[model samples]
Target chain A: MKLTRRMFIQGAAAVTALMAAPRALLAWPEKAFKAGSSDEVMQALFGSADVTESGSVVLNAPDIAENGRVVPISVSSSLDGVENISVIVVENPSPLAASFDLGPGASAAVSTRIKMGKTSNVIAVVKADGKLYSAQKEVKVTIGGCGG
Target chain B: MASDIRIKAKLTGDTAEVKTLMKHDMETGTRKDKKTGETVPAHYITEVKCELNGKLVMTANWGPAVSKNPYFAFTVKGAKAGDVLKVSWVDNKGGGSSAETTLG
Candidate 1:
């Protein structure tokens, strides 16, 4: 009876670990997210802030956002071998909003909603063929999103 | 409990567009409560993963700047109408949720 109970406990523990193994493998970039500025974020995540302005990278955002709480933003790249795309709000306290890593079978575009703390330049950074390219658009916010 | 993720997928030609909306407060941890005068703890989705027919295709890393009820959209290549698309997210507080949909 004692042996059976011990085996059951060990089985349960193994199952729990198996269930969590996948997520644990994809470790979150905590340092990049906590970086206060766009330059810092780039350094923390990509090891450099060097990015060339590119026309192939398109950043779509409103000229004036009535609601800063939910601003629609979309980014697309015509460049081949696009592996990663990141959105940055320059004026936000923490500028690195989101980053998307695309597999080979995935396209080089993404659309999402982000919060803007104030009027800021929204930048789309694309990593294609191991090189970083960026595009930026200034968005005016009537109301801030980070206020309490 | 009801699933916190809503997913929609459509196959156009050889490409499949997958869109997902996740329910999350995404508290920035900088907001103060009006009644209690205490700052709200940070609660936000930090990672999201997308799979096409059980194969990983895309991974999204998000920060607090992502708005509440995050909406994300991406496209996958070489997908069929009946293919299954799965999306899951994990929050900073260790909470997670997932949902799947068949491509139309």
Candidate 2:
């Protein structure tokens, strides 16, 4: 077999075709993602919407997000016996963003990037000693980044 | 083959700052293919865990709302140089990957 320009083009087309094929597997939160309000999403995710504001739970985020598609967020708790952490965007269609379960040996800190539909309050909820403590920061999103 | 996840852990004073970048699409299933005009199926990491010297340091639960090729960073208190750090993840499709490094 001899290499030719035609063969190279054919190979490139084959590679593109393979990439275009639909991927299989994976499950998503259909009901939770479809929820219209923060309360509904919170109820579906954590079984409650009532979170007490606390200064011990520190939420670090930008005051004005350059983009909504990738907003950096970090959470840390100084409270003892903290076992879990949760992130929420109060103005998004499906507000419950992310959650973490910390083990006894694990430190009470987490960081990740999240998408927001618009300007909203970013909330960090830390579960310690079976009680929920939270902190919030308002982030203004720029044009055309995440969600509708 | 499981995709390779890149991780780095370095000591900053008594704390260890860790950074991770994983190769993934993180599809939300809401976006449509421009050519075929069909909704893409959801595929994203649902969980992530980090450990320091064999002890759990952090764990995260994620959703499709996260961006593609996710990047994460955090710090572990009381960590020091030469300590072992490990990071692992499992996607919604049951796919998983892991990587480990010694704090430098």
Candidate 3:
């Protein structure tokens, strides 16, 4: 096949177009992930809504964390039809930590290690039966988890 | 290439406790590269799914805010020993990895 400038240019354009296409489909929540405050992050994630405090939702974390970088946290809810569970570190630069979506028949529990920029309130928000409920605990961090 | 996910599950009565550790940089895209001084692109696990014996059991949605080398654990109801448990993750870049283990 004879190489032509027109064909080469068209091929290059097609390749570039293909390269840029998938990025648009990338499911990263940019605004919510970059939001500074927990409220703003939650608003971006779940819209402007009120979350009720629930005793059925449990948020477990150390009261005094020696290392901010690896704070253990767990969230479990006994509420029926639990759909979503999320972890948020209030004082972190990017406060929204991790989010989980549980399917039907899945237990309402999630555990993970997250970084805390400093002493902060770790919040667990659970969505059950289309209602938002939350539980939080204050953790004192001696050193910043993200850095230092 | 081999996946970097390490998962373990143990059945106790009617519930199976599952623990997993995924090795990743989890770059938030906000941090600067030390050498180039450029903002690193945000790259982290966006979705995680668990299947028990080919049936979807749990799923997770994460962001760059998760720490490097993310560790996650959960429980699966009605799981039993010798059941196949598969854990998989897809990152923001669309790269995916999965590991399977049998509950013990």
Better of 2 and 3 by DockQ: 3
At residue A75, candidate 1 shows an lDDT of 99
Q: Model 3 scores what on Cα lDDT?
A: 0.84
**Model 2: which residue pairs collide?**
none
* Candidate 2 residue lDDT tens string, A27-88: 33445556767667666556677778999999999999878888889999999998878788
Q: Name the regions of candidate 2 deviating beyond 4 angstroms.
A: A1-36, A40-47, B1-3, B12-14, B78-81
Better of 1 and 3 by lDDT: 1
Candidate 3 chain B TM? 0.95
- Weakest 10 consecutive residues of candidate 3 chain B by summed lDDT: B58-67
What are the DockQ scores of the candidates, in order?
Answer: 0.72, 0.32, 0.54
- Over A10-125, each residue of candidate 3 has an lDDT whose tens digit, in order, gives 99999998998896564556677778887887787788547999999999999999987778899999899998888888878878888787877579998888877789899898
Estimate, for each residue in B1-104, the C-alpha lDDT of model 1 and write its tens digit.
23789887878998988888899999999999999999999999999999988998999999999999999999999898888888988898889988888887
- Model 1 spans > 4 angstroms off: A1-25
Best by DockQ: 1
How many backbone collisions does model 3 have?
Answer: 2
TM-score of each: 0.89, 0.77, 0.81
